[model samples]
Target: MTDKATAAGELTDIGNKRYFGEGLLRWYRKERRDLPWRRSRNPYHIWVSEIMLQQTRVDTVIPYFNRFVGRFPTLRHLAEAPEDDVLKHWEGLGYYSRARNLQAAAREVVEHYGGEVPRGKAEVSGLKGVGPYTTGAILSIAYDQPEPAVDGNVMRVLSRYFCLEDDIARPATRVAMESLAQSLIPEGQAADFNQALMELGAMVCTPKSPSCPVCPVGEHCEGRLQGRERELPVKTKAKKARPVFRLAALIEGTGAYAGKVLVRQRPETGLLAQMWELPHIEAPDEEIWNRLDEGAGLLEAALAEDGVRVKASNEVVGEAQHIFTHLVWKIKVLGAAALEERYVADRTGYRWIGPEEFENYAWPNVFRKLLTEYFLLVRRG
Candidate 1:
């Protein structure tokens, strides 16, 4: 906790924003990191950086940010672009929902906000996916508004400086932390003030093995002075490991001369929704194929035909792992023989594209890599 004398003194100077503001500004001028997002005061760039940084590391976001900014240099560019193209750019950098929400928010900005990002908290927060932290981030960092932009880094810094006992797991912690941040925020250039605290947390007062000796506000850090640097920023609980689900299917009856495979479009919801993949069913054990049609079975039943024969039974083409927030899929592609012109129609269309045309379609690179590796090793084995 802040010493009584120091708290009382700082509180007395609260009304005089000039003093606190200049102090923070001076420190920030000497200590801020050279991040790409910090190079410019563009609201759209700040918004993109904040979104990409969610559940993502800063080092990992550098290249993604560069590529993203290169692709969509402005809010108008992103608003007019297609969602899939944006999502494709965001692939490999997981947490795909961010990309979708970003596109939605961009369109709203162009349509509603007159093509400019909102500078106020209420307006920024009302966007589709920008939350309190993001709103503050954009407002302060981009517009130099007096918002604290409190994120995990800010929370840790505040928690340790105040030696806060509140568990950060609770939503109320956010409310309290933001309040405290606002209370201490140096006025005028809210940008530098917010960046100072964030830089302090990220670069010096890290989660573990903090460099308290070199911290800018070392004298003011209550936790550091009390020999509790590592214990100040209390965390909540740990997450349980995600459970894995497996799915597979046998492709059969299709002639090798025509060179086509039986694939299906997944439902328009849930994991990898709308993505095309080979027909498969999720089964735990004990011959999952026994319950499905092979040649004159499920495929024929679904296709309403009997002119089919099983070529490959259950040839595992190897496994590809896909992960979501709460789910994991160990996907196995079972190769099989298939007859010509035997495929389901309507909402799901099965096409036989030429081998060279594989690049023409957009498939999750994970599955594409899996298929490539599987085919390559099959010939060797």
Candidate 2:
């Protein structure tokens, strides 16, 4: 609740709180979708599912979650697996940093906690990539501890139900919401209650337009009663992603390296770290990027500056776009042929791989799609 609400004596009535909890639980038990992660009480499975579910949809994560657990069935397996193999399993799932942090945390657990997730809140929160929300989720859902797993969905639901007009994007507001959420958890029903709140938010109390009439606790929803359900839970908008233009070379190999294409691994740190992709260079402006002949020359010059020589042709091969939280890359690909055999002695990061070796390296989604299409066209030819 905001200070204004508190000062106005607009606290959640005791009756409304009781009804909200009981109504949510009853509705969840009866109408909840049967999810794979809910089938068992395994802490590892629950932790992985929570991590994967962050900023990702439930339906998209189902198959990935199943395959991930099947590949690394236990904490030790995940801790011991090679980074590349772990990355391979998580290839299509964006936000590669999540997978990296998860593996790092798994290794820490294996060594310090003896391959078991710690029950203490501090211990779980200390793991890499496990923030307050994830900590609460693992503690409550996995251990059945009375913790509040408050996320955007939970906040939206609570703000509407309680008619809170606070800006949810603020750190202080989240802390208050977390405190309120923890207080509402029913005794001995932390797991189900927390999940129920999340389910209600996801299904009924949505962001755009809430289905208030069908909501179990709609009878007492302050936002709905006040006719401000959509206006509550105020949030600030994020900055737009900045656009960048890049030129990529689809360099075909010749001589002994025939049937292969040139590729390079990204630096060990920073964006798309350690991922492989077609050789490319950022264009100074969009105009040059759109001009294939000029962009091809700039691409060759840029790669030569880095000791990677290729003869880029004016013909366009492909074009694609990849969006990140802060940046967007508008890429134009040009046909090319490798011009130097010196790369053979340079094992730095460059490689000439044929379609048979596609499975050997993980690629960013944009490049993966481009390469997949290129291979399919070649096969047809």
TM per candidate comes to: 0.79, 0.94
Error of 1 at 172 (Å): 0.4
Our tally of clashes for model 2 stands at 0
Query: lDDT for every model?
Result: 0.69, 0.90
- For model 2, residues 1-381, the per-residue Cα lDDT tens digits are 889887556454666688999999999999998899999888999999999998799999999999999999999999999988888888888889999999999999999999999999999999999999999988999899999999999999999998898999999999999999998998999999999999999999999999998999999898999999989789998899999999999988778887778889998788888999998989999887878888888998988877887789999889999988899999989999877755642657888888899999999999999999988887888
lDDT string for model 1 (1-381, tens) is: 569989888765563334434555677798677899989898898899989989888899999999999999998899899766686678667766688789889999999988899776788899998888998888888888778788888899888877788888788998999998877776576788888878777888899888987775666667887889898778866675565545444353234324434455455566665555555544544254333334224433343332333344444555677766666665655566654444332223454443454454445656567545644554465
Worst 10 residues of 1 by lDDT: 291-300
Model 2, residue 322: what's the lDDT? 91
Which 10 consecutive positions of candidate 2 have the poorest summed lDDT?
A: 7-16
Instruction: Score candidate 2 by lDDT.
Output: 0.90
TM-score of 2: 0.94
**Steric clash count of candidate 1:** 10
